[model samples]
Target: MSKNEKYSHESYLEYQGKYKGIWGWLFSTDHKRIGLLYLYSIAFFFVVAAILGLLIRIELIAPGPTIMDAQTYNGLFTVHGIIMIFIVVIPGLGAVFGNFFLPIMIGAKDVAFPRLNLLSWYIFILGAILAVASQFAGGGAPDTGWTFYVPYSSTSSTNVIFALTAAFILGFSSILTGINFIVTIHRLRAPGMGWFKMPLFPWSLYATAWIQVLATPIVGITLLMVIAERVLQIGFFDPALGGDPLLFQHLFWIYSHPAVYIMILPAMGVVTEIFPTFSQKPVFGYGAIVISSIAIAAVGYFVWGHHMFTTGISYWSRWFFSFLTFIVAIPSAIKVFNWISTMYGGSIDLKTPLLYAISFIFLFMIGGFTGLTLGALATNVHLHDTSFVVAHFHYIIFGGMGFAFFAGIHYWYPKMYGRMYNIKLANIAWGVLFTGFNVLYFPLFIIGIQGMPRRYFDYLEQFHTGHFISTIGAIILIIGIFMMLFNLIYYRHRGAVAPSNPWKGVTLEWQIESPPTHENFEEIPEIKTPPYLFKKES
Candidate 1:
């Protein structure tokens, strides 16, 4: 950065608002501070869920009661899924990076409703607390396997009510954020920035916001129905009470499947930003990527029926869902092709961020293709509840969205914190994390094909080898997780001071001061041309 840029403004970290120390952060409506709050909390839940997942892998190593009993195993996996899916996956990227970067990228000071943004974070915490409290309060931990399917959830003597209430509350937070982002994007762009000229990351968020606004309320009401099913003895999903169990499935997956886009669309946005910067080239087919993001969100809604294939739905329904499933894959595939083409012959940086971005494509492709197998009616019946589905879900969520989270953090660390981490160490952690992920999940596909059902505490001797190998991979994965987290944390406050535009990024965020001032721009920029402009590389 030039000397003129060095002493211009106090970074957000140093800016003292009305409230002093911790209180400033706790009640502040500053979007960057709110984003950091999400970063810390979501990172905590990720490690929490990851530890539960590791213990799960350990228990399955030898097939018969390795570390925990059957009941404990079921409860562990249920809580793990609840936390990872509801808290970590749904809000991690959009709440953290999107909150921090979206306004800045669009040349605004903060989101349209800054106080509403802060309130959403508090609601997220409240819901998260309730979800965790369900494990230990009043009754046994919920064992409905995150699906909380039907009669069992209704009748189970556990804290299912608490979990249900928690999820319901969390949906409110999501809805508010969706509303906030839509208005922010619509009203806050820099003066000459038209929709087409806006960056792709914001476009992905735009599409995702619509899904959040429209789809989340369905599941929120569905959870209330389930709660009523148990407390009011209503016949919502319980068949014995004259309710169709499939009703719950339909309602849940309608929101939950689009919730998949909620998790991934912003992740797609993050990598979309990374690819152009790291490749040192304008994105290939930018308009197509923008369209595909919206396309994926639109098509994602109707494909939920594929998850219910074996539940005895009608033939036409089956064909409709299965067809839509494949159709949805077309847009996702378009994104992958565009990413690769973006890097075709450009000056690829091969940095830690790029590495994770590339891995996301590889693993997400595996997940997407495997998704096809489940989308086919015949194959869906075969793989419906198997370990194969488990592997595919992780490959998509953890491998795709999770890795993209890492990439976004690394790519934006310099700008967000005004410090730099050890590049050599970051790259090494990436390799270990990548290797451990594939080693752990890839085996499940094979064992699942051999007929190992999921949610089982034990398996036959035939599946032992795959389970054992997967367990070891989990161990390696945990080590890498800590290693990566430690490196980032250690450097967050102490690393070398970062330049304003460390990656030579051409976006508005890179043009501003690192750890930007209270008002992002001293004066809002007027955009004259499209984004992703390039200068000669060193």
Candidate 2:
């Protein structure tokens, strides 16, 4: 195609394709459009889930059915976990940012399966609809928690079947997206970009996609098993009904554990892309980072058993899992050290993205260390069902992945929208969000150590102080969240027009027009150096 035809003056947002208006986006095969679709949908689900979580917190503030009854609270948390885990965090980054950038970063026009990409979003929507509908579909929300632990899930009188169907369907969507990314990375990388020559974001997604494809089937089967047991009177999880509970745990966690990586790996990729760009330095230990990404994925698969340490697992099994758990920690630590070293002597820019990246390291360290604590057999026994697990989880998911999501959005907002959000406001919102995040979860670690169990709507008088403080923090967090989101939303059209390469990023996306053309590249660019060559840019 000629340069003018290939690099249209109109952006993807403006390109009038075979369809017009909303239909243009609905049936569109464009990867960017699909990414935005996922973005909008995920954002809505996130708000719903977050509000559910906040209501749960409100109920816990005074310890005695403050705002909601026990059954209502159980239903709230159950739906909250299902929405946050399945709809929000699981597909948050990879589906939104991954769909948007993976092909562009790899120097391709779109995914290996553009049609399938659009279909994945459709599946995602259908599954999300089912998940939410479980709340009001005449039976009330499923109270099995997001994990849907077997006996309770299989026999629960609530809407367990609807939730199970939703989870199963969502897993299918995840598998398809993963397959699409894997094939795209393997086949469509720009000419001259070898395996080692590819950027870290795609590498991260490459590993994540493998985990998604290889591991998701386990959960899909497990969810199906639960649904079958519920509807067909089969015995799969309930011990009284000829099923083993521990077996259920194993099967559920096998996928759920790797699913953690699916949630966080791309976050890692987003920051990996950010560190070098903000520091104006080539990524430190590129080969090490690359290997660690793959290593984490490979090692992540075997560590699922750690989640089952407390379930009367054999002595040898506990030790084996504990050892592998620590083994998995190695690569993550390498990434941390590599990230810090990348900034050690480099000209670091404390922009919005970097601020979030730096905060991620701090929070992830807390979460990672706490995770290792949970991995220990003795501590696992102590904290497995305690509030500490809740604290540690939020730190990792909200603090690590959520902040990284914000950072990626701030970093790429210019390129994605062709406009610049107010930087001062962005910085202010980041500070508020970070502070609110800590205040919200840090107290749980203390209260958990003090013996407060998770999923409880009420607590003893001794734990009352911590819960109260955490509630206040939740309110603050909501404020900060609204502020950050408002800044981005309001600026979509009113913000200053952004330059093509605002951050002066060395990647090919930076070399292209803002809000990249319908086809990402005008002509496929040949890569001849490391992806983050700051010296060349300087």
Candidate 3:
């Protein structure tokens, strides 16, 4: 049989199309295909943002301007932050893996609304275009930072309107995706599959989706208010017109703070899945992990004030937010301990995915602990707007979420593409990336304590040594990233075909055919027990 004929009988990949070539993919409503669509687009923007980050590091290597002037540097900063936060990390795991695997894992044919899922991707792209277009079409690139703090955001000559519009639209896309996931999980589980029996990945998504649906609207409304301030001279955020800038900060953090959980929760879910599968054992404290996810989401909302401790808020409010912030960390710590306990006596497989998972725990621990310093009013007063804050943010987002993303890609790459990446190359790439990552960000902790403010194009001579070392780390990190990307691309065609259950996972997804059939299952699977139940073969 021809490839098309063979796929026609089995997987979505082989489905014949009315529109040949690119058009088919563009219009595809297949959850797997839509997931790949997100993967490709997100990867492209990730590279763009990474390159911009490297440029910033290179310029900072010395005390003076090395590559571009200050204005150009500021533009790059705004664009980089916008792309990484809104485009890459926020939707990273859910849009790619969740869309592809959630239905299969739950024994459903597809998402509750496949068309809306696809529409979300298009809206994301449109938001990205408007954000980038602002740099070229309007007065100049937006320089108010990703937060778009006012009265600077309102009074700035650059295309603040475009930036605001892009963020507003992107919020809509996020909200829609959240709605889709919530409905799917609630309504689509297989026969005998109860809420507790569901896999950790979907459980994580369940928590994340709630945050996305609830918290995103606050930021959306805030961004719209910003546009109003710019275009209609609304006195909402602009102090010049009887508006309170502090109010903008409050509204923005109310969303953005919970938004951090939106980025990391799915990643935690990814780790949860990888642990039991690679260890060849059941997850440790599955209930605790699930409950912690809900706790993080619930408590995440009340801690936004921690970000504004230095904004002259009430002393009681400051301490209250700090208490909530510390409280949120308890559930996260519970998860870490459980993961380690899961691997204690099990048959641990040191695969690439497992390696990335281990790294995530290490890096995320650092990110979490450092965040406590920022939560405290005394330390935050010293570290506010400093490079220490920048380092902490990246550790959580890049070190934590970014590594988990790598873990998920490697863990599920075979299932997604029916091919294996070279294990040796993957290990080598992880070593270099891990080493470079620490060298790149660790020194910022020292310099930040010494009072080096972030977002400056130039720095005092005392900070030059740290910047130089960090710059070198960036170079090394980039090299590792390129090598990893090259291996994935090259092996896509040349690697050996992967088996249906390469890691010997017990999830419903592992029970299906690799790259799964168009409708996922000929008949829906009936769950006999909770997920991650391992069986020995004769």
TM-score of each: 0.98, 0.98, 0.97
Kindly report which residue stretches of model 2 are placed more than 4 angstroms away from their true locations once superposed: 1-8, 536-538
Model 3, 190: alpha-carbon shift in Å? 0.6
Q: Candidates ranked by TM-score, best first?
A: 1, 2, 3
Regions of model 1 farther than 4 Å from truth: 1-8, 536-538
lDDT tens digits by residue: candidate 1, 1-538: 3222333569898899999899999999999999999999999999999999999999998968988899889899999999999999999999999999999999999999999999999999999999989888978789998888888999999889999999999999999999999999999999999999899999999999999999999999999999998999999889889898999999999999999999999999999999989989988898999999999999998889988999988899999999999999999999999999989999989999999999999999999999999999888888989999999999999998999999999999999988888899999999999999999999999999889999899899999999999999999899889989999999887788788899988889999998798899999999987888787532
- The Cα local distance difference test for each model comes to 0.93, 0.91, 0.91
- Candidate 3 per-residue lDDT, tens place, 1-538, comes to 1222221235677676676678788888888998999999999989988999999999999999899999989988998999899989998998898899989989999999988998999999999888878777768888988989999999989888998899999898899999999999999999999999999999999999999999999999999998888888889989898899999999999999999999999999999999999999899999999999999999998999998998999999998999999999999999999999989898999999999999999999999999999998899999999999999999999998999999999999888877788999999999999989999999999899999999999999999999999999999999989988998888776777777899999999888777788788999989879897888521
Candidate 1 TM-score to native: 0.98
Model 1 per-residue lDDT at 66? 87
Q: Which residue pairs in candidate 2 have backbone atoms (N, alpha carbon, C) closer than 3 angstroms, thus clashing? A: none
Q: Candidate 2 versus the native: TM-score? A: 0.98
Candidate 3 residue spans exceeding 4 A from truth? 1-9, 536-538
lDDT of 1 at 246: 92
